[model samples]
Target: MEGQLDHHPTPLGNWLEDLFAKLFYQPDDEICKKAMKEEMSPQLKVCINGQHVPREGFDQVITEARRTYNISVQNSRELLASPDATDKGIGSVAHIQTFTLEDKKTGNQRKQTSLTISVIAFSDGGKQLIELVEIVLDH
Candidate 1:
């Protein structure tokens, strides 16, 4: 933790809420899709349960989830956040949450509570974005 910033912030709630809403309910909205691009880095790295995944694959999962299930956020927590070393007031944010995914076509459901930690930063165009994320889940 020596190199990490000390601040803890959860200001991305609105952004997260919007992401889920648009991702699940409005997948075809051009404006929303355009805006969503600004929220994550093009070179984003995601590790779910210790398995690395590419950005394209990540987006596929989102698409699959949108088409296959109705996801409900049963519980959530903003564990921590810190600013970048440049003091631009951006760094990483962590959240732990339980989600209920009800199958869209089959009516089956599942819970996979997960802990997600993401490093956020300003892109070259001054847009806030998630660059790297690590996810651990309890099934």
Candidate 2:
């Protein structure tokens, strides 16, 4: 029971753009996950620092993210506005997201916590899946 990005028959470009803003950049993992499954193609792939991670489905990405940080995902989400233009698909989105990681064992909050601006790429679909995400770290 899926619908096109232009389910209302508006416009792909504008509809897709706004859909991404709510899903990928939202402050809720549940919301993002739901949108990812709907928008992203089965052939989704991701690259980090020029290193490609093969067959990285949406679910795996979230699982790996939690493991890599060494802290439980407390409340981490993004708020994106719009993106520029790109060759592949939609350009990278400009967003501001907040993340708080808590120690897994002791449940202690990390000292280093801040909000940041990030760029996110989206796929062309009704759901608008995030193809790539790059965050500008704050010192």
Candidate 3:
């Protein structure tokens, strides 16, 4: 489905947007680390391009991102939500992200890639903690 940015009225939507903002735009590693530790569940699962990424590898991912690419988040919006009978809910968020590869030695910008990311988030504990995150990249 095509993704559009809009103000989502639900609490879960607000939280998801805030998470994305801190993760993609904010450059502070400490803030990012705290957010991950506080917002993610102990059994959190993350996937990218249909491949599962170990929880322990998340720090590496962030480090790689900071070292390898200059990222800009064009937009992030909530697409849909599926709430269970309890407080758990699953939300789909769309992110328009642009990544430009950086040359390590020359500090030159290399290839630029713009993609839409469909993020599926499984939220529990009153939608405060994310238990699962599946990211699908669209070119």
Candidate 4:
């Protein structure tokens, strides 16, 4: 039952949830850096709003988010999970995230969106590390 879904933090599902909480909701740079270093594969691919973002472009996305949104994320809830049939180790989850953003000179704005996050867990030195992340914007 090593890969069983009955576990409290079903390997792939739990890790993906935590990753999104840190990257999108909390916005912790150090944690994000560490997660990327330790969890993600070197050939990671990320897509947002239907556009593919090469691994190297991740920093730019982070920078843009910081500049445009100064956001505080709240009410993050995992809505659904879809496990991959072809790969038992892969899973995807739909999450509802709520957040508020403020521009010091402008005003405050609140928004909520559903995001689908997909993760692939693969063995690296006997430890399962997340090798792929495919994030989809759910409108």
Candidate 5:
């Protein structure tokens, strides 16, 4: 089941994770936000802990994140195990990542905020972007 992550490496998941890991180590907020913009679907929706955010979108999330912290993502990795079938078609990928975040001003921080993201991909031509859910599974 967990081996499933390797299956989607060609479609962009690995690249995205690597980008996040790099952003986590960098100090530039704008660059991190730019990278996120490249990864997001135009109309993104995220479901975290059962609370649904409709059309909350990637831009909004980035804006909010920037407002809250210096915004760094660390220790990003993917977890894939036993994917189940889904109706929208790109199938489903189960992946988890851990990152440490620090406050912008105080430099206060927390370690090991693990997240499990469920992604669905859609294509126009040969390009793909994640079109579905992302969430936090570890606190």
Candidate 6:
């Protein structure tokens, strides 16, 4: 997919864009920590393919994964996105993003695309935070 940055029209859109961009450039522990502390809600949960990751383990799983794979964004496309469409200050996005993952030890690299959908809701202070994330690898 041809990488494009012309679709972020809302806070959720911008958040998704920023998330990928951060990983593309950094792909480090800092990004993972930042995502967990600043972006993901304390109650946040993630579903990868069919595996479920509860809030208690979300940070550890993600942090370990980030450390394991040197991932860089190759391209991204928004399949569907919305801004507060439900009048409950809720936003959602469905996207397909391509990334290049390199193994640190083996020095092997491959490109993979994943279909991801994320739900965002406004916090009490009016900041948008990711509440749920679902991703299907090799999609």
In order of appearance, the predictions have TM-scores of: 0.73, 0.42, 0.61, 0.62, 0.60, 0.75
lDDT for each residue of candidate 5 in 87-125, tens digit (9 for 90 to 100):
233444455566655677788876555455545455433
Best by TM-score: 6
lDDT of 4 at 73: 62
State the lDDT at 74 in candidate 6.
Answer: 84
Number of the candidate with higher lDDT, 4 or 6: 6
Count of backbone collisions within predicted model 2: 2
User: Mind sharing the TM-score for model 5?
Assistant: 0.60
CA lDDT, every model vs. true structure: 0.65, 0.44, 0.54, 0.57, 0.52, 0.67
Regions of model 6 farther than 4 Å from truth: 1-11, 23-25, 83-90, 124-126
Evaluate model 2: give its TM-score: 0.42
Candidate 4 segments whose C-alpha is farther than 4 A from its true place: 1-11, 83-90, 104-107, 123-139
The segments of candidate 2 whose C-alpha lies over 4 angstroms from its true place after superposition are 1-33, 55-58, 64-91, 96-98, 111-125, 135-139
lDDT per residue (tens digit) for residues 19-113 in model 6? 65653447566775766576667776677777888877876766665777787778877767774633443688777878887888898888787
Span of ten consecutive residues with least summed lDDT in model 5: 81-90
RMSD of 2: 10.6
Total backbone collisions for each predicted model:
0, 2, 0, 0, 6, 0
| List of clashing residue pairs for candidate 3 | none
Candidate 3: Cα lDDT at 44: 60
In angstroms, give how far residue 39 of model 5 lies from its true place: 3.1
lDDT of 3 by residue, 60-100 (tens): 78667766655555544444444531144445433333444
Indicate the residue-level lDDT of 17 in model 1.
Answer: 38
Off by over 4 Å in 3: 1-9, 84-129, 133-138
